[model samples]
Target: MSRTLVIGDIHGGLKALEQVLERAHVTTNDKLIFLGDFVDGWNDTPFVIDFLIDLDKTHNCVFIQGNHEEMLLRWLSEGHDNEEWRLHGGQSTVDVYGKIDADRVSAHINFLIKLNDYHLDDQNRLFVHAGFTNQKGVEYEYFKGMFCWDRTLWEAALSMDATLGRKDLFYPQRLALYEEIFIGHTPVTRIGYSVPVNRANVWNVDTGAAFKGRLTIMDVDTKEFWQSRPLPELYPDEKGRN
Candidate 1:
């Protein structure tokens, strides 16, 4: 049977992204879901976008909008840079693509603008760049920002006392809405894990590709995972966002 692979935040680490894909042995037959943050941090933001565009032509790929993508899109459309975005590696993206042609920049903007806030597959697995507020279903159209900016959902999952036999007694409906929930905004490295962290039914795959950790890809069904080399090793010449 074909497999479904969900990838974590990329953060412009093109080499790391490629390494993770190769480690996963991704094929056109398999479905790939990216939990966004494709740009910002590393120096190859434009190349990362181009690589995904090319991959989409051959493989079944789903791209979800991340907070970085959100800020980039806003800057592109509003003709002004977001200070917060720039402070968090957005300047690296701007520095790389600042002098590119108008058409190419526009293409990147178009791609980022079309990314989904979240995706639900046939098996009921939820894929999102960040956690969602509603357990039923996200009102993506009205509160799209939450889909890529919320941390409370992940915090709730982490704080849940799984020791309690009756999980329903404490926020039962929250994560019970889906078979599995995959997110990327909060890096696992922050909690000292160089690998994906699983709490409750939520899986955080972002192994901190922009930091000292590696990028990760996990099989939705089997829960097996693959990872790239450390981010610093992948880009020896540049000091990424840090």
Candidate 2:
């Protein structure tokens, strides 16, 4: 069986990432799929990015982009004063880099810009950062809403009762291309195992590590899951999330 270790949003939690990887027992042969939002929330973006870059050199790894990463890229490229981004743990990421030098900041933005929007494996599995979509072909923007939005699609998919049939409401393109789609954006109260939504299989590993929640990792082949609580200081207030 193909072993894929899918991890939830890291949010710059380097300790959590290390702990979860150890708990999940990720090996060299296994594919490590990070569900994005690797920066922000925690004050360790520099360390997290450095570690992930090093990790990529050693193993097969896929890093999907998330909305926060998108915003970061936009601000860095356009010289936008993003106080809103800063409010939502973006400042923490900035803190890690220590007042972004032009060259170093460009390097970081380049890394974020290069992240894949989605990953579709031949094993009927789809991996994305923020959300999932039924859109296909020309409709799929390589760096558009498919990567960072689509929570509405998720909720509609989950509200279904059956586990095998497709839910029409969830399909933006009215096509069921994936038998199982794993995503990280909406943090479920539970962690580890797959959470089924109608015929749409959602494995949200985000565990809200940046908001007083756990860090989650799941083995896609075996459906095994692992979790660990986040540091209290990393917790965000309700308003902070806005």
Candidate 3:
């Protein structure tokens, strides 16, 4: 049977990304849902995009727009950035692009431009780089940026009162909107977990490849996970986002 895999933030750790896919025994029959931030951090930012674009030709791939992708696009296409972007692994991407030809740079820009803000599968599971705020669901979301920047949804999930039932008036409405929500951006490593963290119906899959953790991919239905060696080991010479 085909599997639907939800991947965590890559942060340009292409070696780690490749290893986990191999360990997971990923097949072309499987559907890959990337949680974004494919660029920045490591040194292979451009190569990772190239592999992803090529992978899409043979397998079903869903790409969610990450905040890093958005930041990279603005810098590449218009030389615009939020200033803080450089401090958070953005310069690594800039370093790679500085040597890449214009044609490839343009292609990478187009790739970012085409990424989805959020993807809701037939099972009503939402996949986004970050959480949405509107209690009604992503359809009712007013600020699209929240799809790649919001942390409150995951925070709420993490802090959910175990005694709180869905029917309770005080229960978070955001958690009730989807059967399950898969998100990246906020690394679970912040709380000392290096694996996928589940709280309520939301799963935070970012294992902090940008820092000292590993890159991960999870079978959404089975909840079985595969991870690369800790990224620091994969690229010992680099500090990544640390």
lDDT of 3 by residue, 101-182 (tens): 9999899889989999999999999999988888898999999999999999989998888777777887898888788999
Cα error of candidate 1 at position 92, Å: 0.6
- Candidate 1's residue-wise lDDT over 1-242, tens digit each? 58999999999999999998998888889999999998999998989999998899999999999999988888877777777888788988888887778898889888987899899888888898887776666743356678999998799888888764334667557577777889999988888899889888889999998888899999988889999999899899888876
List CA RMSD, all candidates: 1.6, 4.0, 0.9
Candidate 2: 10-residue stretch with minimal lDDT = 190-199
TM-score of each: 0.95, 0.82, 0.98
The lDDT values for all models are 0.87, 0.70, 0.92
Q: How many backbone clashes does candidate 3 have?
A: 0
Q: Write the per-residue lDDT of candidate 2 for residues 71-127, one digit (tens) a residue.
A: 777867876658888988887666656665778777777787789888888786778
Top-down lDDT ranking: 3, 1, 2
Query: What number of backbone clashes does candidate 2 have, counting pairs of residues 3 or more apart or in separate chains?
Result: 0
* Clash list (residue pairs), candidate 3: none
Most lDDT-accurate candidate: 3
Ranking by TM-score: 3, 1, 2
- Please tell me which model should have the higher lDDT, number 1 or number 3: 3
